[model samples]
Target: MGTDVQVLYFGILREMYVQAREEHFSLASGATVADLVERIGERHPPFVPIRERIRIAVNEEFAASGHVLSSGDTVALIPPIAGGSDRYCVVTDEPLRIDPLVDAVAGPGQGAVVAFVGTVRDENEGHEVTELRYEAYSAMALRALNSVIDRCEQSARGARVAVSHRIGELQVGDAAVVLAASAPHRAEAFAAARMCIELLKQEVPIWKRETSPDGAEWLGMRP
Candidate 1:
């Protein structure tokens, strides 16, 4: 069978493409991952970022930039992650129920519940932030979040968790996110909650935009 070529896009690049994935473009007999990126970027300059930091995969396994791509290969553009807040009562595009997460973690044996809520601050770095905006590739974002939650569930000692995040234009002090975890012991809850937030920030596909005194700009993940 002939090889098929696919183009994957993510992050701000998606905003430019206005779609999650692209299905056009095929290898001419033979093509490498780098060749595909060059063709795409030549056709779509915004794909430059994808060329810079994207991870290439054949099928599902990670490949190098120079890897040869076969037909029917599924390529994914993975973006750097920004941490989600450490707070319970988290909100995303829609509202979330905190009580359920609380119930999931509570136990007669567990003693303490630790929760964190992240609010959009009016100020960032030095300027006054008028509002904040959050955007995501919803399907991927939710999947990544669920993955983090599942991992935490295995490690937390009877921990229950709740998270909520806000999307669209959000004013300062508005709730951007919430996380809560309960464990048999306070220490475990605290640790679990912290880990959850850290993992989310590092893995989730959510990005933030900040409107400040000067203007608006997208926020990047801290190294």
Candidate 2:
């Protein structure tokens, strides 16, 4: 007897293999997430090196490596994401514009509005980069961003916050993120804007993949 499982690949993992996005696997009964990973490692040697950084999600929920797998279970291989929704918190592949984001949070009674933009640079880690790819788990990522905005709003009285992150491939000089905040005073607006950017980078599931003349690699998954 064995457990039949479906495996899914997302973000930077999709570029690792030439096969379809989803694959089926057979694991011995009572297998754990680690067991399933070992099986995957056998076929895809590239996974072995970064195996420790990869997280396993069983049935759409994060699971421990030791969790037991059941027959017909669906598993996803999640790489560290770059991280979150609506007009206030957006996750899009289209070009990011600062004006719209600024407007979203700007309104009457607000004396100061601050905006931040993160652009693709030509150099990183002493390497000459040509392109960068951002991957994300959209729905979940959006929720995370919303949480950030909610917290910023609560911390800064009368402050409004909005953020947008761009997904997919981007060239040098492309805008990757647009964040804005408005408040009754300049100090409040600045504080809210800082909180949003810091939280967005740390908690968001958006992952960055840098491409240079040598090759491309997904960051934040180091062993």
Candidate 3:
């Protein structure tokens, strides 16, 4: 008999599995997480190269390589937590705002605040992009975003961080994401801000589709 399980993808994995966020797969009874990973790698050749680097979580908790998977199990592939305070992480349909997030992370003792804003571009790969449609698995995205904030806070040693991502259709020049970091010094704030954005791009479950005169296509995972 086979055990049916739900596989969830984030970051690069989500881009690789552009069709859906949750997928159903059946494996032999008593299969381990490693077995499932091998099956996925077989189906998606790109996953093979980075197999060792991939992390697994079962039922919302990190799982070891030998963890046994049961029927109806939920499996998530976590890339990494690269790198917060009132540390805010959110995914909303509302437009992204920077001032509030910056204020949210700022502390009286902090001397520096750094913010990063990501906006939709008018062109990509020679195509004149008309707009961009962003989508995410809300629950997972929030968790991943929070994880990134936590990492940033840890790396900056008490630095505060805030991040907000906008989802749904967005016109060119619209702010798609906003991140802010505050620390006792400029160096820590800048480093935390950079780490937050990089990790968010590499770990969050958010996915973007570009619409252009040529049609629409999902942007692939960043290398």
Candidate 4:
């Protein structure tokens, strides 16, 4: 018998798959995440365009392409998010707060806390940027953020991680993202913090638009 997995779509995927945000998909028993994605791509032509950009999460945690799924599992096709929350992964329109995120990752046993803040810059590629706007596929972004945190935590044993990204209009010098990592040693904390931000930029589905004197341009892959 086939397994009935609950599949969820967010961001562009939600817009493309308008029938429903959540659907029951039938897959062979012991199906891998890649198998389900392949099925979806075949069923929905639009999914084929972003097949590589999309990330998968099973039951709210990031799942690998090879991760196995079972009946009743909830699989989410994450797009990316904004804003801040106490949770390890947050996306919001509100301005990012750094102190709380740093404190959140700090613990009694942790001797080092590393924090990284990414702010809107005045220029990019020689273009004089006036302001920046950020957007995300919230549900997917949150999942991706959590995935980055999970990786950082795993790479830096005993480390705790917290991260936040801000959406909407942001001026130069405004904080766009903040990441914090705490561990028993400075090395681990530093490594975790670096990994968290790098993975976030590379993996998360957050998009940025730059408004310059010339014009406005959206950055990253088009959906």
Candidate 5:
């Protein structure tokens, strides 16, 4: 007997394989995630290079390599999602630029532009943070980011908003996020900017990994 599964890909993997990244596979009964990965590699030799780093998810939940696959399961091969992005509601690996975002939102009628930049600090929770790694479920994260922009613009009258977030390993002093909110007045701009960021944190599916001198751990929240 064979167990069938839906395999999905994200980030770099998705870009590399394009439409072929998602496929329906029939595997031997009781196959493990590792076996699925190997099977994919056999189909696409390029997948072999990053096989070890790809995180597998079963039905939207992160699954271990040894997790047994069941028929009808949805498996996602997640490459570092913050590892890539689509600009505008940007989740990119490129350095964050606030000027572009500021100019983007600023308009002829808008008199105030509230710009916010989030940088990686050298310490967190009394720990000396050496670096930070960011990840996201790219497709969903983009939608979540756009949702925040929509909410801010609607709630704050005359507000125009733009946001950019970076992923991948970043050092201290690097900009993790940059945003601008423009409005006819300072209050509206400020309110929209604040609301956008708060909503992004609450709703987006981005993750952060903090590395200290001793150890490192990942969080479901943005850093």
Candidate 6:
């Protein structure tokens, strides 16, 4: 395989990806597996974790650390899977709503209103989860979330929008997610909320950790 392949270190890999993805790396034309990883570490110290728990894959197949890397070969770094939440947790702590936190956006003349509530599920991918811990890079996460809300409001000028998510450990039934938008009509409100949620998921620097009967695992990069 070629040495210049796309690398994916998802799951528990973010801790390392965050550091390594930041720096530029160069490899000799026919570097070996050890060479690439060494270069990665030289560029970003966090990748040192790879020496122990990280897994290597070449072109979608598992490979030993000594595997040779050729030009055009896809190299992937797979970190252990940290647990994920049972469901999307959406919430707003101040008020109680029968319909979920997103119901906060309401207007009499508005023809359309839309909201999304993410609940905590009891299980994730078959694991019995006891609770979830959310960690946020407050400044970045909030900025991203507010930006999403702003976009929702801009697209539907008359819309009222709200977004609230929980941080810290949360038990089942706790609200972990909330998105609400009200517009001149339902379609715009719904569309705006959907877009906002998608953007938040993609851009926000929030991470979730899950504690299950078996053990505790991180869901994403700790922000």
Q: What is the Cα-based TM-score of model 5?
A: 0.61
Model 1 C-alpha lDDT per residue in residues 1-223, reported as the tens digit of each score: 4457775554334544435445567666567778877877777776665456555545545567778777778775543333322222222443333444464456687798776777888788887999888887765765576667767766865766655555677887776777777778888888888988999888887789998878888888436
Task: Report the lDDT tens digits of candidate 2 across residue range 1-223.
Answer: 9999999865345565424467899999999999999988898887787777676767755578899999999887754333211235667666777876676678888999999999999998788999999988876886688788888988978898978798999999999999999999999999999999999999999999999999998987658
Q: For model 1, state the Cα shift of residue 83 in Å.
A: 22
Q: Which residue pairs clash within candidate 5?
A: none
The candidate 3 region of ten consecutive residues with least summed lDDT is 79-88
How do the residues 178-213 of candidate 3 rate in per-residue lDDT, one tens digit apiece? 989999999999999999999999999889998999
Best by lDDT: 2
Angstrom error of the Cα, residue 12, model 3: value is: 22
| Cα distance off (Å), candidate 4, residue 45 | 36
Q: Model-by-model lDDT, in order?
A: 0.65, 0.81, 0.80, 0.79, 0.80, 0.62
**Residues 65-146 of candidate 6: C-alpha lDDT, one tens digit per residue:** 6777776676655443222111112221222232432334665777777767777799988889999887776545555666
Q: What lDDT is reached at residue 178 by model 3? A: 92
**Root-mean-square deviation of each candidate, in angstroms?**
13.0, 13.2, 11.2, 11.4, 14.6, 17.9
**Ten residues in sequence with the least summed lDDT for candidate 2:** 79-88
Question: Residue 196 of model 3: what lDDT?
Answer: 91
Worst 10-residue lDDT window, candidate 1: 82-91
Better of 5 and 6 by lDDT: 5
Model 2 deviation from the true structure expressed as Cα RMSD, one decimal place: 13.2
